[model samples]
Target: MITQVQVKGLMFDPYNNAYIVILRDDEQSEMLPIWVGKSEASSISLALENVAPPRPMTHDFMKSYLDAFDAKVISVVITDLNENTYFAKIHLTYVDSEYTVDARPSDAIALALRSHAPIFASESVIRKQSSEELDQWLENLKPEDFGKLDS
Candidate 1:
């Protein structure tokens, strides 16, 4: 089972010295947080704010390639969680044929946002990521912790 979700926010994790991209369903009942690198976070942030960089970033360049090929991202699906790592797939349609490509969640999300495609997550992944530890961490987050990606 898969549930439709959206990029809720980007947050910094001081303990891990990493950024977390939060995805949540419409009702906010299920949340998935994926730890990502600074570059990936920046890309996702730019998409979230609809900020176009002076030059096309990696995700933007990828989107342009898709445009050149007349391909459309149908959706992005967070498919699995293994040993604390999450997996995702980019569903695309080109020349009347659909294809699914494996991708990191962060990259898939950035492209999805850029292409106006929907995001989703497997029900099992949602359950796996929603734990007591994560609940405590989220509850402890301060408003200042959530912000745009630092340049």
Candidate 2:
């Protein structure tokens, strides 16, 4: 089982780097935050804000490539989590065949936004890997708090 989710926002963790929170679309109260590299965070931020760059970024190039090949990104799936890392896959369809490729959840999400693809979290991953305390903390967080980060 997979639950649909939406990008909640990009956040900065003062002690760490930046992270983007995703929330269950059906149950807005359920959420997860994945820490991402600065570059990836920027990419995700640009997309989330609908900022069109002068040229195509890596993910934008991917969207063009998919379009050129008549392939559509069906959805992105948050597949698993191990140790402290989370994993994801991008599902694509072309002609009569479908394919899935491994991707960082953040990049997958960036592409999903460009392609208008939905996002999903595998039930197993959520059941076993999600942190309730962290979720609660994020839920209570305000955007102003993210601006206080030294980064």
lDDT of each: 0.88, 0.78
lDDT of 2 by residue, 70-118 (tens): 9999999989876657789999999999999999887888899888889
Residue 81, model 1: Cα distance from true site in angstroms? 0.3
List where candidate 1 sits over 4 angstroms from the true fold. Answer: 131-133, 137-151
Error of 1 at 93 (Å): 0.4
Candidate 1: worst-modelled 10 consecutive residues by lDDT: 142-151
Write model 1 residue lDDT over 1-151, tens digit each, in one string.
9999989899887855678898988898878888888899999999999999999999999999999989999999999987767889999999989999999998999999999999999999988877465789678966555443222
lDDT for 38 in candidate 2 is 78
lDDT for residue 86 in candidate 2, whole number 0-100 = 79
Per-candidate TM-scores read: 0.88, 0.82
The best candidate by lDDT is: 1
